[model samples]
Target chain A: MNKIFETPLYPYRRAPEQDEERIMRHKVVVVGAGPIGLAAAIDLARNDIPVLVIDDNDKVSFGSRAICFAKRPLEILDRLGAGDAMVEKGVEWELGRVFFGEREVYRFNLLPEAGHKRPAFINLQQYYFEEFLVRRLRELEAEGRPVEIRGRNKLAAIGAHEDHVTLEIDTPEGPYNLETEWLIAADGAGSPTRRMMGLDFVGKVFEDNFLIADVIMQADFPTERWFWFDPPFNRGQSALLHKQPDNVWRIDFQLGWDIDREHELKPENIDRRLRAMLGEDIRYELEWSSIYTFQCRRMETFRKGRVIFAGDSAHQVSPFGARGANSGLQDTDNLVWKLRLVIEGNAPESLLDSYDFERILAADENILNSTRSTDFITPKSEISRILRDAVLDLSAEHEFARPLVNSGRLSVPAVYDGSPLNTADALDGPAISRPGAPCPDAPLGEGFLLERLGDRFILLTIDADAPDEIEEDGITVTRLALSVRDDTTGALKRRYLGDEPSAVYLIRPDQHVAARRPSWNENLFRAAIRRATGKE
Target chain B: MTDLILTPNLDNADDFYATLLAAHEGLTKKESDALHARLILILANHIGDNKLLEQAIEAARKAG
Candidate 1:
């Protein structure tokens, strides 16, 4: 932690601006300053767009809420110039061990194949993460693009028209009215913003309740993903242990539906559960614990008129795979570029609709996959439980059951099939065929992998015969000058060209392949550019 | 051409095509052609579905 960041970064003490007066009018007003909202706000502000970020909290919350973050979000934070910061302040889990009853069934390294530029997953408490983001936002504020952080304020009402949105905000100062070109509701599930818009968040709410506790322990343990499928602690309880940055440990206990809600959550009851779970012989002190119920749902529409939804406002998924926060941050990354184009007038208001479509697809994917993962761990039915246990038991001996017991598919990235931006043919291989899938890390220069794609359009030409051409619309075209037969780049070669064909691939701003062709025709190339940039 | 057209969410393809056709009601071949090109790009931008976008563009071009 930096010395200056320990205190309030941006201290704006105004002498009560008038109620009817416009204190500030920004291009974008992001509601809530959590990870997702803060990501969107800082992204816009960093790019020289003034953003007013309002949150009702007096200061950053200091509890561990959303803890686990995946590789994609780490890449997103890397783009925001916080990759190194996260690495400095977080713990990375490279290995995982799964236990089925008292037996350890499987042990595997997450980054076994080894080609990605970033690690698989990092665990950083949401409290510390927000503090880091707020610090960075304050630094950007000093450089002219100020992110106005207004805490102790809640959104009262928001109405949008063709050109801009009118917001009636209730602040500690008083009821204030402001206007903005765009309004983003990054508020959490049970969002007041979504409710006000009359949008139905359709999904199922799971019946089981999970109790989480952060404890300080003096036990000898290794830094690995440790889980007990069916622990001896409680009859129907499952437990998870995570090694955080400090010596502290985060443990979660699955409490079945029949427990007394009021009596079970007390400190004494929690201590008893901990002693029963970890054994009384182990010395420990409880720091904090809370019981929570999780649900899985996606909003009907991510965008209603000019007001858009991000994070929990748009979707809610089971926290089994840590998809909830990661997906929200991804929504911000997908949205910021489209919002930038609209704000700069490079694209029409129609471009904003892509944010909704892309995010909704991602959210649906997350909800479905996370729900399945939860079911696998804590089966709702007796038969399902028996089947899951049988699979886990067989995983130790049978080859087929090993892969079945892995249940690691939730971590894989979702591929978008219906995206118009993808121009690859159906015959293209898995590496390059899918629409809106993140391009795999390819070797660039001597030691550099081509995974450091920022906010720009990239054109990769693997075929030596392809012409050297770059568009005036800020597209960067790089030539590989390698033969199409090269196995190292065979996927790119095959997708862009057939046998003995030229290798050319156009990558979008978000790193998905925009277009690929064996040999480039100038007219077709120009049309692809126009379509990609949403120009007719 | 109608000023506004109500379409299904772009998640589904059949709804998107229906909406495009509904928006182009009572237009000339040339008007429809230009409109189709513009609509393909617009809808492509909406769905982020590159395959659907490619399909829409090829269909519009073939129809013309």
Candidate 2:
């Protein structure tokens, strides 16, 4: 049963502010309650910033739109108190097989190592992901945090004033006026807020159409990603099959550039294709189906005055590599801390320009990868098609050709290289854990290093001397001392220390490496704290 | 930047040309194009250096 979509999780209710005449002002107002919007709201509310989220619909999204959740976003969710629930209800897989015709040519393991807390990727329905975020928001509400989600509240109009944003919200009762010091637009690809502000994105629109069908069956296919190129079932096209929780499988078929979508979406036609794929004897139920065309594009800048855009509203990409939603979660992960600091007067308003620099680079990288994948998969030109078929043919017998095969590059966290906020690297540490890189998770005695790091600016000293705490301006930087003996696996030494015996790292609140050195120096730490917080 | 290698690199010119032509026997024009595509890709990958391959591409386009 598709219970998640049919039920109204956040039904419309009459709020007291609707009856009042004066406009209600909030610390932050978030538009749309999708995964990105909810994440931003939860992060802000958890940090004691009052936030209100509004959405037109009252339930989790209609269908399972996005199904792949990568690890870095999962780590971000964990920081927001919703990670374990998602991992528990999700299907984790690292094995993926790429098939040419009927033979499997390329097999890949996304994560080949151990000693990490989360898997490389997980397959879970978007509805479950949204539900988990809403549940976490409810838990925070129970803890008396100032957060609210108003269903059937549509942001009909928006205007940016000098230091705030004004909104005219349409509700079940009627239209009400609201104002917020800062506005976050987490609306989806067709963002009304963006349209209201006379903003548009410059990008490439792919002509290909992809039909996605979520089917329920008791088939015995192993829990792995299987991609087919020029298979007998769908000749001259590509298909993808992935397993989700509770015997639901996501099957995506490329329908080329020109086709009657109505004819293709017919029940009998869909059934015929499914039968051809799963043999004639298997019986299954169609849970959901959709036809989508994607574009790789983004706004010139994510922030405009007091209004900031996040998620698909700010950037959009094709779903082949599952870059759409994964990058959306990362947007909010990079945003909330800066918003919090700005709201509390801890950091200057210019601190948000770093968000634009970092996330836009990530969006460009995602667009580049997904566009390449789309070109390889679709091959719009005859010459492109020939080259693609060549790679597929050679991959059957050649090990070198396997890497040339492009099913999808998949999603990985973008390392913010040359970010303005990062201090100069003082230690020749591991390249993977350098300045502006996310802190790699290392196993502590009973937990993980990231868990101990939490959401704060920290001075991490390994086998080195450091003060207990240091405060710069209004922000506090605490020290977490560790030894090589803490981790028996030597991941701590290998990932952080490398050949250096002693090391010190200044970690940002977003868990990015702001600076690092061989050992702690009082003057360097003070200057670094200033630079990392935008006081310099 | 270095120019494309214009001189002959293969040892057996006649034998290799014969083998290349024979591989396309009994194939249609589309099939022949596919063979050329595969051949070019395999040979290009064997060279592995992107700069050299780009130079080769430039030479071929210029010749056309």
Candidate 3:
């Protein structure tokens, strides 16, 4: 029997009356309980910053949405203690094949190089992703970290101030007022919080529509991404098929702009389309179906005084590239650390400005890539279609044209090339893992390099010894030395040291490289730290 | 590498040009433009090197 996912409703509890003598104030209050908000809550709670998360709904996501989890998000999740469960429940895949009309045009491997800690990508339902994060949050709460989750509570109104923000929340019984020092608005795409604040998401909305369906079947298809452009099965349109956990598959059929959504979603029509794509003999059961048109847009500013936006509330993109949830998780990953420092009085509020700058750049990158993919998949004019078809026809015979085939350019980690927090590159090191980039993971001793960093600044040394301890201001610097261990297999040297005998890398609490030099100096290290914390 | 191929490479250049023109015959202006766009993409894909493609694009943009 195929297992069907059911969203369990949480019972609502009455809030304390507004006339109470004193109301509880939290350091951070996250507005949504989706993947992004929950990740931020978990990060803040893990850092011992008390967080309260309020959600209008109680259950997990309803359908199989946002199935692709990229490596960078996985790394971030691992830091939050939920990575192993997701990897265990997900179908890991890296190979993708693109076809034009029945002929195989090109194939690509996402992670051709090996020795990384995480896989290239994993395919799992969005509900399971949120459930795993909620589980991790409960584990942290059990350990006496002040992380509270209140469901069935909606944010009715919001007022921002220079010092804090006041929120009016409506519960099942009545309404109550709450105040928080920092507000993380992670409420999803149609964010009520964003609407309440009168902020607009500005960008382009593609005219094309896509039909997404989740079906459960026992078939022997290879566990890889298969995308067809104008295939015989679906005439003159595009189709994508991906394997997920529990013998379920996700199929997307691109319908033109003039589709009758209601008529297309009928059971008989869906069955006919599935039959045409998967053949009559393959007996399958439908799990879910939806019609969607996506927009590649973002808010003008991610940080607005005391009210900060993350995830879909701040930016949105088409689902073609699997960048939506992955980038949202990254937004929270980039945000929580800065918020924690600012809340702890260790870093100035100016540090949060860097978060806005860096993530806006990242959002722009995702939007640009997503727009290109949308344009390629659904050509607006005859000229565009002609060029797209020519590229497809030539890709089968040539390797160079394969890169131009953008069947959703899969998500990759964004490098902050000109981030204000990045220190100048004074050392000759591997360009692949540079300042402002996430530190590449390699085996160190019995653990991984990423496992040794984060939660505090790290001064990582490869093939060299550093001082026993370095602590300045409120930042605790942990010194880690990695040499040619049996498990390393020269990965550490290749990734960090390059040709140098010894090198020092300064990594931030978010595991982003802050600076690097051939040799370590206390004054220079302090200067880099000052710059990273916005002291300079 | 120099992108200019001054040497004669095609064996039947006259026939190839005739066929190319024939492919455009009887097409409207919009259709001809679409065909030209497709031909450009196909030929660029055939010449896979990006540096060479850049040089070719610059050379084509320059007026004689």
User: Where does the lowest 10-residue lDDT sum fall in candidate 1 chain B?
Assistant: B1-10
Tell me the docking grade of candidate 2.
medium
Per-residue lDDT of model 3, residues A1-536, tens digit only: 23333654344666553567676676899999999999999999999999999998887777888999988899999999999999999998778889898788888776655767788789999988988988899899999998988888899999999999999999877788889999999999898989999998877565567899999886787888899998887777899999999888999998877889999899899898888777888888898899977678899999889999999899989888899999999999999888888999999999999999889999999999888998898777876888888778768876766777888877887888889999998789899778998888887766777887856788888766678678778877888876655444788888887887778888988888999998878899989998888887
Better of 2 and 3 by DockQ: 2
Ranked by TM-score, top first = 2, 3, 1
Which segments of model 1 are wrong by more than 4 Å? Answer: A1-12, A15-24, A205-207, A257-259, A406-410, A424-433, A443-452, A463-469, A472-502, B1-64
The TM-score each candidate achieves on chain A is 0.89, 0.98, 0.96
Determine which window of 10 residues in candidate 2 chain A has minimal summed lDDT.
A202-211
lDDT of each: 0.69, 0.90, 0.85
Candidate 3 TM-score versus the reference: 0.92
Residue range A1-536, candidate 1, lDDT tens digits: 22222344334343244434545556788988888889998888877777888776645644577888777787778778776788788888777777777778887676643545566777877777888888788878777776778776678987778778887777656677778888889988877778877786876655567788877788866888777788776555567788777766788887866667778778888888788767788777676677767778888889887788999888887767888788888888878877777788666667777677777788888877777777777788765665667667656665455555534354545565565544544324445434477666544434323454566666565543555556645444544454544446444444444454454556666666667665556666666666666664
Whose DockQ is greatest here? 2
- Once fitted onto the true fold, the runs of candidate 3 whose alpha carbons sit more than 4 angstroms away are A1-5, A17-21, A106-111, A205-207, A485-487, B1-52, B58-64
Please identify model 2 stretches exceeding 4 Å from their true place. A109-111, A205-207, B1-27, B55-64
- What level of docking quality does candidate 1 show? incorrect
Ranking by DockQ: 2, 3, 1
Lowest-scoring 10 consecutive residues by lDDT in candidate 3 chain A?
A1-10
RMSD of each: 15.8, 2.1, 3.0
Residue-by-residue lDDT tens digits, candidate 2, A82-154? 9999999999877888887777777877664677788777899999999999999999999999999999999
